[model samples]
Target: MAAHRARRWSLGGFVLLVSTAVVAAFAFLTTGPSADRADAATTALTWSDEFNGPAGSAPDPGKWTLESGGSGNGNHELQYYRDSRDNAALDGDGNLVITARKNTDTGLRCWYGPCQYTSARLNTARTFTQAYGHFEARVKVPRGQGMWPAFWMLGDDLGTAGWPSSGEIDIMENVGYEPGVVHGTVHGPGYSGGGGIGASYTLPGGAAFADGFHVFAVDWSPEKITWSVDGATYQTRTPADLGGKKWVYDHPFFLILNLAVGGDWPGSPNAGTAFPQTMTIDYVRVSASGGSSGNGGATRTGAVKGIGGMCVDVAGASTADRTPIQLHDCTGVDAQKWTLGGDGTVRALGKCLDVRGASTTDGTPVQLYTCNGTKAQQWAYTSARDLTNIGADKCLDTKGGSSADGTPLQIRTCTGAAHQKWTLA
Candidate 1:
């Protein structure tokens, strides 16, 4: 057999430079204080598959397709890939389980030798591929010697350009020998196989990854790619980290999930290894950086312009707890940036606009508090320009109906007063 090359990929050779017009257009649409802040504080759910079907059901064909064969996959793997439900099926508990089982049947064939195991590899290459955005998956990986499970992406031009040139983003890759560690890597020309640019993150407290489901995600853009496990970011790769090599992850890529029995990196499973190892996947989601289409009930974040054209600001631009939230000059500062969340909360400085102590009486001061999902933090920025606090049943008011720059904000009965009227910029 030929040397089984470790599967890897690269970004394309062509460079598509960003134009000034395109940057200006993106800046105008996205909600950010400055034009260079392309990664604004908004995301539109573009695609997702929850795999929430009944027990023994196959994955939705509309969203995924199985890649079957015993071609060794350039890794001299031991498993014979198959498109059968026996290898991949949904467990009643809202998960897609891809199982690698010991194949004991006689006369079974594989590229290297007798087919000793069977497994499944699934991809969304045809159904969905995206360029820049956030891609995430929740998975509980199986454990044992030689157990290799991965959640990764490949450049859309794989058919023509092929590996090492099509660009590959390995969001999550686990080799059972290192049960507590997982890797995130990128492959491209001159950086394929053992030469890929990447990093690894170990679970805290020396915990095995099989202990529970964990989220693996990546924030991909033209400038960089950030990998995180759960909510903690571990590594970020940028053009400067490429060691003067060409950066190739500027185009669209498709998602792939697979569990392999034995591969070059993990070696072959031994007698101590367990049979029927399974990897459970909860869901895969992709989000894009763009303006809301108003179709998914997505929230809008921007400056809340009020009377006298001043902005609803966080006092002293502070993130400190119990910071006074008042009206100030509209300067497009972070303190003035507010997101009218779908959950009915006006959030800024990573906290919610809250009525002090959830008070119901008039003239109670408004403050920025840690978001607790309480009713006091809930608000409705209506078309009539009133920011009403639901728990207090009062409108956000400027104290004494003052339009001064340093006036404090409070909650009062909804009386349609000029102080209660506000506009979102």
Candidate 2:
């Protein structure tokens, strides 16, 4: 009856969706001339569904609609989706839950149930649609074989030209089999469904995307489609490479959130895959132009020492002045300014050291003394590619010990020092 019944979430605000895990991952996937990047157009507030308000309801009718049936257009998938309380619901925990449980929808249920799988498919098919805008969400995935969860967009004129011609933008897609990996794909003419060409990546340390919730986003603009996880970018796509496929990017399109099962891509549920799987959506948000500036102005790479949370005044110096170490905000100030000579040299206050003088001691104030060329400043980034000063062991560090207004700059030691530890790109 009502629209957008919501719930409680950990993402802090009603806009930002939250996931239940911690991965501290950063890296973008696409941007620049990609279909996703064509988001700099159309209605300002357009449409959005965080599925966050109350419970037992469809999304805001002002924004989205529901798509049902087997052989969904093409993907050759199985589930019989619907716009009902049983399929989609606004769980009290601040989530728009589109559960893919193992239930039966009687004859209406496709594939037959206790249809091996039962879930909902939510989309903004007709009605409100925009040409381009930043599409992002915070979500936690369900773990199970044959499970297909996706956050994507499609052309508003689907009834006319149909898929590939109508262009489909898959901002994020992941199978239950590959938990830590994500796929960013585009479908049109030569690149739709089975022939769709896209790339995938496995985040560092074998990160688990299903570990709770992670922010999955796509910066859609005219130039490119940049895919990012937890604010970190990873891949990109462009139009030229689209082999004659219909470019629906120029027209208005809406977003869709669904948990598909046993499709042409994910195949069938395997042993590891579980039942009653749910793709918890913390929020599905749409913002007018000005998509998030990569990591909100976090420099691509800079002097390490003294870098702290969101360029905050660290050590009595102004934020814009000295080389406050660039660190993961809210974690601690110990990971700011670090060296880049290939030796992990984190610098601070004219010194290059990280974390308690690298003495493995606690609370040891990082000093800007000198570069002893010790292991303290010799940090090695795994799977990270960048040019560092492998010779002098000098680091890109902060000079002053002030978190106040503008402070001076320079490089120093390798202590587990609070002022050292820098972000190298």
Candidate 3:
């Protein structure tokens, strides 16, 4: 796929690193509000690694490829990137250290033959690819004036379809100057990037990214791409923006880890810039389970209108009671202001449309008021094609248990119930 061009402000000098603070890493996600067929037990997790043994023979041919060139692919920094062992090394310590050393190779032309430094660009392009799945990586970067390290994934169909056409998701990108701040960006049609191409997320503590490794992840699906660090989700985007350009991301993609030196990103290296800057990759993984498709659990898709019954951007809301509430129109009202969430339970008013305070006794009206902090609001759907409210031990029931609207949705005990259980219907 073609690389997307956007206005990128050299933030290497702008973002100041935090010098004092406690490091607290945590992910905010619900574990067991209820049980579903797709519970942790039924799912499986898969894994893979570069595993170059001890010699570090230039990223495995089965797992990765070296992207070559020094033509300043837009970001106008200086170092020529090479695919040699000196730059990309794998030691017995179980780490892939891609270094950007101030050396130079002369075999090639380009007049100024061997310059000052070379970096490595590697990717898992040929072996296998994936789409709409979970991806995560743990890495530690190097610090200095010109060092720029990125842990990201790109669409493989780029050569045929250009950028802004084939989507790009940047999980973590850090510059030496801005040590503690990390960037999470998305590139596509309208959400086109460049002038500061993406966004920046800073840690409370001024922990230089070059000092320690951090876990970066992406929960991607057919609907959107969410970028998180240590479990804190920071960015998300929908299909409408890129689908118009031909939803290239709907297909599979691979992983890439590169420690670039002097690109258009971090500006040219300064005299103070350190030599042999390195980026260490602990591991890269992809998971096929534990996710949310943004389908509002009901799978009821006709025309998404309001928030609560009110606000405009359900895209920005996230909380227990505050979630996208399928509403009627755009009148300025609290009920209209819907907050969308990663968790499946969809809410509008303060509370969840739970089985009436978790009362399994039949005819529990699905009400929305305020959050009562009880199990009644907990809901779960299973792969067994069933839906249940764990607290009350009941299933969502349709009035007369019919599939018609205004059937007055409620909750009833499960008894091999069909209408009572659902799968996004």
Best by TM-score: 1
> TM-score of predicted model 2?
0.55
Task: Judge candidate 2 at residue 360 and give its lDDT.
Answer: 34
Better of 1 and 2 by lDDT: 1
In angstroms, give how far residue 288 of model 1 lies from its true place: 1.0
Q: Write the per-residue lDDT of candidate 3 for residues 281-304, one digit (tens) a residue.
A: 888876444333232221221122
Model 2 alpha-carbon drift over 4 Å, by segment: 1-46, 109-114, 243-247, 290-425
Tell me, what's the RMSD of every candidate?
15.6, 18.2, 18.4
lDDT of each: 0.76, 0.51, 0.55
Model 3 accuracy (lDDT, Cα) = 0.55
**Lowest lDDT block of 10, candidate 2:** 1-10
Off by over 4 Å in 3: 1-43, 50-52, 108-114, 195-198, 239-248, 290-425
Which sequence of candidate numbers ranks them by TM-score, best first? Answer: 1, 3, 2
